[model samples]
Target: MKIIDVICSKGRTGFFFDDQRAIKQGAVSDGAAYIGKTATAGFSAVRQAGEAISVMLLLEDGQLAYGDCAAVQYSGAGGRDPLFLADDFIPVIEQYIKPQLIGTEVANFRALAHQIESIEVDGKRLHTAIRYGVTQAALDAVAKASKRLMCEVIADEYGTEVSDREIPIFTQSGDNRYENSDKMIMKGAQVLPHALINNVKTKLGENGEKLAEYVAWLRDRILKLRLSQDYTPVLHIDVYGTIGAAFGNDNYTAMADYLESLAELAKPFRLRIEGPMDVEDREKQMLALKELTRIIDERGIGVELVADEWCNTLEDIKYFADNKAGHMVQIKTPDLGGVNNIAEAVLYCKQKGIGAYQGGTCNETDRSAQVCVQIAMATQPDQILAKPGMGVDEGYMIVYNEMQRILAIRRAKANQ
Candidate 1:
């Protein structure tokens, strides 16, 4: 019942994070494709320079299972940030993360999973990025050994029944979203068209105008694309905390005023803004988000606030839910440690009467994307983002096609 080996291998990403449409439309710079995909860490200049990390767990009985790790831009500060980077992840998983689990007993999937999540280096918890990979591999190992689907392992472990149903497909977008949006509707997807505005204010000298332009483009896309549904597609803009940095808590009046201005452009379109701002103090930051949500709620604006930063772990998720910081909170899969944690967070959102979006970085591999789809279907989240790439076509196919496969299998088994 003990793990015999752990292997970590290298891989590459599909595209660097870029707003191609914005670039084509002259909203952002030509260099933004590389610069915009990065976080404040000022690490690498290569925009799409990402690594795919796969963790394989070998049991003593020659049974094996594995999972892939996705590299994310804007992973924030701390060892946990950029936890999937090749130099950071490979050595740690091989030297530190592996040894601890290689000989560990796996009699209980839930308990072993907890130990992996809690395993720490230098007195700090294991970086969440590695936790994501190892935990999924561990779960996969155990689930496959039991001849059950990964979600089935989750259901039996958590005392819930597996709900074999189709989960809504949520995919990310670049500036070339018009073409991507057309393809999304063709495949029956609920699109989350986004605009990256973190670098806009600095490069363009005016953030609002650029954001407005992006919003206007989205409005037109919605109109001409003839979105298959009656409800408008949710327009998301990752402010990367630039907006919050520009307008501080001391300037609450200004903050509300600017947010209202943005809302005006997204009028009648369901608007959700991610990472509006970030602060050094997490509790204080959550409070600010709560207050902002309060303002938006009181005004009855169409904009719904979402928390990405400061909302990584289970505690962070519960804190945001309890305080009502956002109408919806992104339960970022990689940030939260593992898949089961997402299950727990989504349930917490449900209990709190808030929305949950199952999210991950585009740096993820296709295997991880498909695995996430299985987990999302088990939980039935409000929405789930396509992974491992910026282009809507491949990411969309990886997820929805898997969903189709799983549904087909279930139907066949049920009829038999």
Candidate 2:
């Protein structure tokens, strides 16, 4: 099938765009919004409604293949593209991208996606969100044209197998950790409660006491609220570098000691700490995480380190994976630009013996989350994130349902 037309429309993401800089600077939360001046250059407020552009490709067969262009919750931070607003980007897409996409063959997702990835305006490439959504539409179009599931298309193109079983789903608990943790437990999330411990004073605590208490509480809560005794979810917390802030960024010894304590408290539940220390620079962040990971391994600490900050692009992921920066590297989908790159990153990480958490931002769309599920199914990442919103139920539901739908179709095809 050929792309007959390219359509773009403004849409709302499942969550709001948060200024990571402001939040890190101690922005106080007032109700659902944050009360502080915007620190990020493009942010209009400390917190603002997240926006996405739906890229729809009209195919010759009258099938409409679409994907949502979305940025992460903390857009413009950790060396990501600037704030992605629909109004600012729609014109750019129409002027530069739409024409190229128009009449293009959709037979090969990798080829078409590479063409989209290669587009440039005034020396810089298209925004990650645009590339992300456009490539998603491309993949969808290819799948539709072939009359196959998206996961199957990906598997064929990438020389991988579609997971016959379900991939583990990781759910995030944004601020409402306690309430969301309960929901996660009830839903039997393979990975429970990201427990957004971004702030030191309130979430992580000055001396890391607060997070320790929260982990202890989380462990107890799961044991108390779980419907089945067999339900044992991995506890993965994203502290956003507060641990490094509290214990001193370079103090790997102290950080390892604290992580060991958290592992002890998490008792029988595997623990992974993400973004343990964001030194704000890519090289330094890698080294810091590398040293930290080394320390934990040498000491035989049970807690696993997850790299997030400064690990944005495909190149960054490979670099981090090669250096053993962390046990797992969150392949933040949107940051990597195209959906094709998400699959490649996951495959690469697995090849390198690094755990790939096929994670995107909470600030994504349902469509984006669904596409991610297909990619995870084909690539078989260690864990896939329940995304687009912080509310545990909606994100989890979207991810879970998509996985089931794919699995059902795959099984039916096999039986046939």
Residue-level lDDT for 75 in candidate 2:
95
Give the per-residue lDDT of model 2 (tens digit) for 1-416: 79999999999999999999999997899999999888999998999999999999999989999999999999999999999999999999999999998999999999999999999999999999999999999999999999988998999999999998999999998989999888999889999899899988888888899999999999999899888889899999999999999999998888999999999999989999999998999999999999989889999999889999999999999999999999999999999999999999999999999999999999999999999999999999999999879999999999999999998887888799
Name model 2 segments beyond 4 Å from true: none
Estimate, for each residue in 1-416, the C-alpha lDDT of model 1 and write its tens digit.
Answer: 77889887887765543332233223334543443333434344434466667888888889878887664544544123543466666887787788788788766568878888777779977667677777788778877777777776777777666667777777776555567766665565665665445554542124456666667676766666664448566677667666766666545566667777778887667678887766756797788889888988888777878887778777888998899998888888877876668778888898899888888777677877877877776777788887767788898889888888878877787899
Q: How many Å off is the CA of 103 in candidate 2?
A: 1.1
Q: Quick one: best TM-score, which candidate?
A: 2
Candidate 2 global CA lDDT score: 0.94
Q: Which stretches of model 1 miss by more than 4 angstroms? A: 15-42, 46-48, 59-63, 78-83, 103-107, 202-207, 227-231, 245-250, 261-264
lDDT of each: 0.71, 0.94
Question: If scored against the real structure, what TM-score would every candidate get?
Answer: 0.86, 0.99
